[model samples]
Target: MKSYSAVVALAGLVSSVAAHGFISSPTPRQPGQGLKAACGDQVYNQQSSDHFGNVQGALQNLQGSQPDCRMWHCKGVPFSDAGEVFDYTPGQVIPMKVEIRAPHDGVANVSIVKVSSDTVIGQPLISWDQYALTSSPLSQHPDWTSFDIKMPDVSSECAKAGDCVIQWYWDAPKISQTYESCIDFKMGGGSGGSAPSPSASAAPASSAAPKPSSAAPATSATPTATVPAATPTPSKVEEVATPTASSGAGEGSTLPKSFTIDSFITWLRANAGSDTATKVSRAVAERAHPRAFRV
Candidate 1:
């Protein structure tokens, strides 16, 4: 009965916010059972019929909206008081879909944050951009469009730890505005799975900040390097839009069946010789962050 009400409630808000979009998959919300659980029962009451469309700020419509020191914005007070959680599996390519009401041909970005408790929002665990909606203004009105988002897999470590939030932000086409939404989920995978750099927490094949340049670490005093050393080699493999042709890797292969540039680099690290590997390794680190790489 209550579950039905939650669905109906969200549905009611779905009508007027036809200009932007909302998460339609993996169930988004505050904590308890569903959206109502995480966001609070009263959240539905505050909608102004046109709550989502044309809002200047992401959480501008929510009551008590305030600056979240750690995040782009917050509802000042917990809409649903935080702690309720959701569970997801690590290494699973979860499906995240969105319903874009008004097409602006914008772009979509997804990020994840690991929280220690339900009440606190943690620092960034994964920040990915353009994981979905390569371009925005999806279709046009009357022809509302659907964006199928490829959610990157979670690290086994974070999942077992419990409590996390997956945030989706869509850039308003031609405008400097963004629409934000989120869903809380816990990773339900085993602990032995591979993990990567916190920065590498996002999908490299389809998402993440713009590629970085190698200017941060190129020192004239130490021009060359070897062995392709990584301050830390993030083990989480990113799934690409196109799967890579499976290499004849043996049982211990640490790669996915995606022919990504990173995967090739991994192969190069092993077989491409030390000098080449060092050059590429530093370049890779520089790309992620100029200061992100080290010997």
Candidate 2:
């Protein structure tokens, strides 16, 4: 009876030591063939028996074996066994649920991490400076087990599956124990992704439109470029009814098509014998200088 009692106590102690916490919703990475290959048979089997095992415990079993284990990152789990990827978009509110088999007061945070480099992509989606505390009643802090994480505009970085994960990290500094749970996800892709940057969206429009030449204004010395000569509107110039070669007495007359005050004076000097021209020239001069041509 004493031996049986000792065995029961030992089993309870081992269970309490191995089991801790893990992400329950969104189905996090679990032990698989890939984990066995990367973390080796001993460490892998240990974790396989108890999915909630801490990282420090896994690291201790990984001492001799150089198996592709990165115990500190995602509990040495690889993407090969990451299962289904959850699809998300920017500003999306994702509901998360965690299972805490044992409580060890610590700090916890959820962040988007790049799988390959194990680098956090941005600030944590959610965090608790003091989480899973034994001093506080579990009923007091309900957010410790269930909460929501809003997705960020990661753009193209997390567009593909297996590239990123929503990792939950919990560290108990006092006990030197760390636990991780990774939920594989893919965000920012297709038409539902974050809008393209302003510069990128305007690229095609800029390429299609004609760009102004820097030297065209200063270098082009064409007479047609002066005043209304370059203006395509000829009807405005023709609207002014004037005595010129087009409407004058002679049909084949060789004179300027449109004449200014100075040009009229020149024409009058050359045609001094024409009484009609002289009369029109005096009328124009009177209108231009009323005080000078008062008499």
Off by over 4 Å in 1: 1-18, 30-85, 115-162, 189-295
Would you list the clashing residue pairs of candidate 2?
Answer: none
**Per-residue error at 179 for model 1, in Å?**
1.1
User: How many clashing residue pairs are found in candidate 2?
Assistant: 0
Clashes of 1: 16
Query: Which ranges in model 2 have alpha carbons more than 4 Å from their true place?
Result: 1-19, 191-295
What is the alpha-carbon lDDT for the whole of candidate 1? 0.37
lDDT of 1 at 160: 44
Task: After the best TM-score superposition of candidate 2, give how far the Cα of residue 239 lies from its true spot, in angstroms.
Answer: 99
**Candidate 1: tens digits of C-alpha lDDT, residues 169-258:** 555333323455566555654433121112222233332232121222223211122213223344344545454355522213344444
- Report the number of clashing residue pairs per model: 16, 0
lDDT of 2 at 40: 84
